[model samples]
Target: MNDIAPQVARRVLLLDGAMGTMIQSHHLDEEAYRWQGITAEGSSEILNLTRPEVIAQIHRSYLEAGADIIETNTFCANRINLLEYGLEDHVDIINRRACRIAREEARDRAYVAGVMGPTNHALSLASKLEDPAFRRFDFNDFHASYLEQALLLIEGGVDLFLIETVFDTLVAKSAIIAALDAMERLSVHVPIMVSVTFSDASRRTLSGQSLASFIETMAPFPLFSLGLNCSTGPEEMIDLIQEMSETSPF
Candidate 1:
């Protein structure tokens, strides 16, 4: 574990709240959101460039508000997500710049956890109805895209990586694999935290895998922590969290 990860177990760390809510408070128009025609609406990652001052201000606000960890505003900086805005070519720089901005603001005051969102697209789905088991992007394709983003994030000086808001197991597996590969290739190890979204009271993912099963599937990877996020209120998640605490290794 990184210095920060150990403390997570021993103490309560306050993470900053939603990034979009903070950004929306700025009232930035389309020009600011687009940042020179490189990003589309609903994609906040580009704020790191066009409105970096805004991003920095938000980070400072969270830190002032007593957040222990500030995540980079690069949730969609990966190749898979960036492709939605025609940003496939700028993947490396986008992620690096976002992490750099957060690192500067954090400045040893807090940990900068790189935020990697689940890429909702599927690779193993076919275009034609004739074959259902076809793939537009295979496992290697998913691995390479995630590896590229992870490398840049590490180079940009994040204290750790947070694979968050994950709904699909396949994509989560790909991200975990890519992160491991990135650490090996870069020769730098950082603690990784995995968070999955719950479908409902069942404590299963949208794909219908139980929390215990999710843990089982992800057991091969060394994760600093694994828990739930999104699609549920506290009343629904309490039992699930308790279940994970009793079942999970980390």
Candidate 2:
């Protein structure tokens, strides 16, 4: 769990691809996405509970394909996003089960990366600082939701955390804070990887922060690795990554 970047860099460390995208390839409909009492849009995280064998199969595919790190299917398992599906009560169930499945699949051969993605309620904008007129989930809100997921993932046996697809630095901060707190409570420390998404060709986050600003904003955290994902193809990312490599301390 410690110095994971060095460990990963030691060999051909392969990370599993998109959980949502792979799930969609199954062609599962709303019925496969339903909760006991809630009507729904589509939520990929629910598959861990509703169709666990499928999730295990996904993890097995990556591991069998020689993956070094397998991310749990808990991308939208946080409380804020569960509210959108009216399954806020099932956050613990979703995340815990997802981690357990990944852990069981990975066994001793690979690492299980506890996945945390941005919520529908952006703590940056929803709890607007410059504009108090807008408010919902603030920094505290993000902290609680993230801490809940982190604790469960750790409990379910994960080696590290992957706070991926973060569009706002504050949102990532909240997850980092929660991770620190969760580790303190559990009396165990694990590595954390932070990845962000860009809006377009601007090389800036959707929150309007430049790549440098984003790096500066996240500089204080004890991250295992900080990089980009979900936007800007490999051609553009290579250049951006070179700049970040020269600039980033974590």
Clashes of each: 0, 0
Ten residues in a row with the worst lDDT in model 2?
A: 1-10
Clashes of 1: 0
Clashing pairs in 1: none
TM-score of 2: 0.93
Model 1 stretches with alpha carbons more than 4 Å out: 123-131
Residues 1-250 of candidate 2: C-alpha lDDT, one tens digit per residue = 4235567778757788878778878888777777686666588888887789888988888888888899999888888888888888998889888988887888778888999899876755645568766868778988999999999988888889999998988889999999989999999988999998887888888878888999998888888888888877878788788889899997
| Estimated TM-score for each candidate | 0.91, 0.93
Model 2: lDDT of residue 130 = 80
Model 1 vs. true fold: TM: 0.91
| 1-250: candidate 1 lDDT, tens digit per residue | 2378577779999887779888988888888867555647777887777888999999999999999999988888888778888878888778878987888889878899988887757643353569777666777888888889888888888888899987778888888888888999989888899998887766777767888888888888899888777758778888888988998988
- The lDDT, on a scale of 0 to 1, for candidate 1 is 0.83
Taken over the whole model, the C-alpha lDDT of each candidate is 0.83, 0.85
lDDT of 2 at 121: 68
Question: What lDDT is reached at residue 4 by model 2?
Answer: 57
